[model samples]
Target chain A: MQYLNNIGTYFLMIIELFRKPTKWSVMRHLILKDIDDLIIGSLGIVSFIAFFVGGVVTIQTALNIDNPLIPKTLVGFATRQSILLEFAPTFMSIIMAGKVGSFITSSIGTMRVTEQIDALEVMGINSLNYLVFPKLVAMAFYPFVISIAMFLGIIGGLTACVYGGYSSVDDFITGIQQDFQPFHIVYAFIKTFLFAFVLATIPSYHGYYMKGGALEVGEASTTSFVWTSVTIILLNYLATQLLLS
Target chain B: MIEVKNLHKSFGDAHILKGISNTFEQGKTNLIIGQSGSGKSVFLKCLLGLYDYEEGSIEYNGEVFANLSEDKKRDMRAKIGMVFQGSALFDSLTIEENVMFPLRMFTKLKKDEMRERASIVLKRVNLEDAHKKMPSEASGGMQKRVAIARAIVNNPKYLFCDEPNSGLDPKTAIVIDNLIHEITEEYNITTVINTHDMNSVMEIGDSIMFLKDGLKAWEGSKKTIFKTDNKIVTDFVYSSNLFKKVREAVLKEQG
Candidate 1:
C-alpha cells in the first residue's frame, strides 16, 4: 500500500509536470546551473579521483601480471572495463550525490520550510515545476558530461602508467581499442542519466515535502544524500545485470 | 469576496482550526489577529488550499474551492496574490526576475512586456532601482516591499498577506500596511491580512476577526473594536503600554 501510494504520488507529479509549460523553462535554468556547478565544483575531485585511481589500477595490474604466458595487454583491457562500466558511474555518483545532491536538498528544503514554496503557489506558479523540474534536467544532463571527464581522467592515468614504465602508450591504446565496445560506453551513459534523475528527483522530493524548521530541512538533506547514493548503487547493479546481460 | 464556512483542520490528534467561518469582503482590508499559536497562519493556508482541511468549504465568489478541479483551483490561485512572512523572495533570481516570475509563468507576455509590467509594480512599491539586486542583498524592509511588488505584479483579484509587516521597523510596517490598504482600494481587490499588530488593526483593519486558540473570539470593524467590552479583546488591544496608557487616560476623562 505504501509502495502504491508512492507510485501514485510520482504519477501525479509527472502529470503536474506536463500541465505547466513554465516547468520546462525552469528545468532549463536548473540544468544550466547544474552544469556550471558540476564544472567548477566537481572538476577538481573528479580529476583527483580519476588520476590517482588510474595510476593505482595500472600499477597494481602491472604487478599482478606474473604469468609471462598472459598478455601484458590484458591489464589495459581490465582497466578500461573497470573505468567505463563501474568506476565512472558508481564512484562519481557517490561523490556527486554527497556534494551536489546535499546542496540541492538543503537549499530547496530550507525554501520549502520557509514558506517560499507557498509563496510561489500563491503567485499562481507551481513550485514543483519551478523548483524540481529544473533540478531534474540538470542532474540528468550533467552526469553525461562528467562521464566524459572520467574518460579523460582514465587516459591521464594510463599516460602516468607509461611514464612509470608499467606499460607502453601504444600497448595501452591497443588494449583499450581492442577491448572497448560501443555498448559499454552506451551502457555507461544510460546508467549515468538514470543516476542523475534519481539524485535530482529524490532530493527535490524530500526538500519539497520538508516541514517544521531548520532541523527538519537538515534532516531531509542528510536523508536525501544517503538514500540517493544508496539508490544509485543499487540501480547501477540492477542496470548492469539487465543491460550488460 | 472569500467565504470560509465551518473550517476545521487537524494534524493527527491535535486540532489546529476549530470551525472558523468568516467573510472577507471585496475592496476592503480584512484582518485576522491572533497570538502566536492562535492558528491564523494555518487558517490562511487552509483558505489557499495549501492545507487540506478535514472538514469545511471555502467559497471564492461562490465557487467551492475543495470541489474544484486542479486546473480550476490553479486558475483561482492565479487570481490570488500572496505576500508571505519573511518576504519569501527567490534567492536565485534578482529582484526584477522575482517580480517577473508570475507574469512569465502565467502569461505568454513577451520579455519586454514582462519587464515593463515588473517595472510598473516595482515602482508602485517604491523599488525602482533595486531590480538588479538579489534578495540577499536587500534590507529586510526592502525585501518585504519587493515581495509586495511580486505579489501585486499579477494584479490579482484577491491578495493574501501573511504577516506582511513582520520583522520590519514600526515606520516600515506602517508603510507596508498602508500600501496593502491602498492597493486593496485601488485594484478593488479583496485583501486579507493576517497580523497580531494592534497598530495595524487601527490603521487599515476595516474589518477585523480575532482568533483565540483556533476559535473566532470576535469579529468587528476597527471603529467598533475600540468600544467592545469583551475582556479578551480588551486584554489584547491594551496589552501594549502605550495603548494601556491611552485607555487609562480615556477612562479618567470619562470618570
Candidate 2:
C-alpha cells in the first residue's frame, strides 16, 4: 500500500507540475543562484570525461582495423557517436546529480524540517509549486545548456588530437560531417529532458517528505544523490537502446 | 469559534491525543498548554489539517474541516493564519516581502495596496522600519514579530500559534503575548496558541486546555486554575521551586 501511495504521489506531482509550472521570476532566481555551482562543479568533471573519452575511443577505433581500406579517420565518427549519444548527457547528469541535486535536496529538506514548508501551507501557497517546480524547470533547461558545454570539451579533445598530429583538423571535421545525423541531436535532447526530469523529481520528492531535523535532511540529500545517480545510469542505457535501436 | 470533537491521533502504536475535545472562543486567547512531548503541538497540527487524525472532527465557524475536499481545504486554509514555533520566516525574502507573500498569492490587490497592508501589519506588531531587513538580520523576538505580522496581514478568521514565546527573554515574551492578545481582541478572531510558558498562561490565557501524557487532563480559565483541586494541574502550575515556595507561603498566610 505504501508503494501504491508513492506511485500515486508521483502521478499527482506530475499533474501538479503541468498545472502550475514554475514562475519565470522564480526560475530565473534559482538558475542564477545555482549557475556558479553548476558550472564550477560540473565543468571540470565533464571536461575530463569528454576529452579523455573522445581521445580513447578515437585511439581504440583506429587500432581495431588491420587493413587500410577503411579510412583511419572513421575513428572521429565513433568519437562523435559516443560523445553525442551517450557520453555528454549521461555523464553530465551523473555529475550534476551529485552537485545540484544534493544541493536542492538538502536545502529543501532543511526547509521542510524547519517548518518553512508548513508556513507556506498555512499561507495557502502550494509549497510543492513554490519549492520544487522552480528547481524542475531550472534543471530541465540548465542541462541542455550544460550539454553544450560538454560539446565544447569535445572540441578541446579535438584540438589535442590535431596538435598531437594524430589527426588533421580537416580530416576530423570530415569524419564528423560524414557520420553526423540530425536525429542524433534530437535524440540527445530527448535524453537530456528525461534525465532532467528524473534528476529533479527524485531529489525533490525525497526532500519534500523529510520529517526529522538536520540529521534526517542530510540523510535525505545523500540518499537522493545516490539514488538519482544510479537511476540516471540505468535510464541512460535504457534510453539509448530505445532511441538508437 | 473553533470546536474539536473527540479528536484522536496516534503514531503507529502510541496514541498521541485520546478523545480530546475543546472549544476556542473568538476574541480571546485560547491556549493549549502541556509539557514537551505532551502532544499540544500535534493537536494544533491536527486542527490545522497538517496532521491526519484517525478519527474525530474539527469545526471552524460551524463548517466541518476534517473531511473537506482539496479545494475546500485550500479555501479554508486561506482563512487561517499560523505563527510557527521557530518564527519560520522565508530567509530569502525581506521582512516586507515575507509579509506581502500571502497577499500577492491570494489576492489580486494592486502592489501599492499590498505594500500598504503589509506596512500596517508591521506597524501593528511594533516593527516600523525593519521591512528591508532579512529574517537572519532580526533578533529572535523581532523574527516572531515579523511572523506575527505575516500571520495577521491577511486578517484571517482563525489564528494558530505554536509556541509563540518559546525562545524570547521574559520581557519580550510578555510583549509578544500581549500583542497576540491585543490582536485577538481587535480582530475578533478565534485564536489558538500552543504553549508551555507559564507566564503566557497567566497573562493572556482567556481559556486554557491542559494536556497530560496526550490526554485532556484539565480545561478551565486562568482565574479558575488556582482554585481547581486537580493534582496534575496544580503540579504543573506550581512545579517550579520558586512557585512552590510562593504557594506554601500563600497557604501559610491563609492559615
Best by DockQ: 1
lDDT digits (tens) for residues B1-255 of candidate 2: 999999999999999999899999999899999888999988999988888899889999899986677778877988898999999988888999999977876777888999999999999999999999999999999999999999899889899999999889999999999999999999999999999898887789999999998889999987767567899989898899876776666566666
* Candidate 2 RMSD computed on C-alpha atoms after optimal superposition onto the true structure: 3.3
- The residue-level lDDT of candidate 2 at B67 comes to 69
lDDT of candidate 1 over B122-194, digit per residue (tens): 9999999998999999999999999889888888989999988878899999999989999999999999999
Docking class of 1: medium
Every prediction's TM-score for the first chain? 0.88, 0.82
Tens digits of lDDT, candidate 1, A1-245: 97577657766776675455564555577667866774456777777787778777777778888899987677677778777777787877888788888888888888887778888777556677777776666565666556665676578658767988877887787777774579888898889888878777777777777678999988988888888888898999899899988
* Candidate 1 docking DockQ: 0.63
Cα lDDT listed for each candidate: 0.83, 0.82
Q: After best superposition, candidate 2 residue B89: deviation in angstroms?
A: 1.4
As a TM-score, model 1 comes out at: 0.92
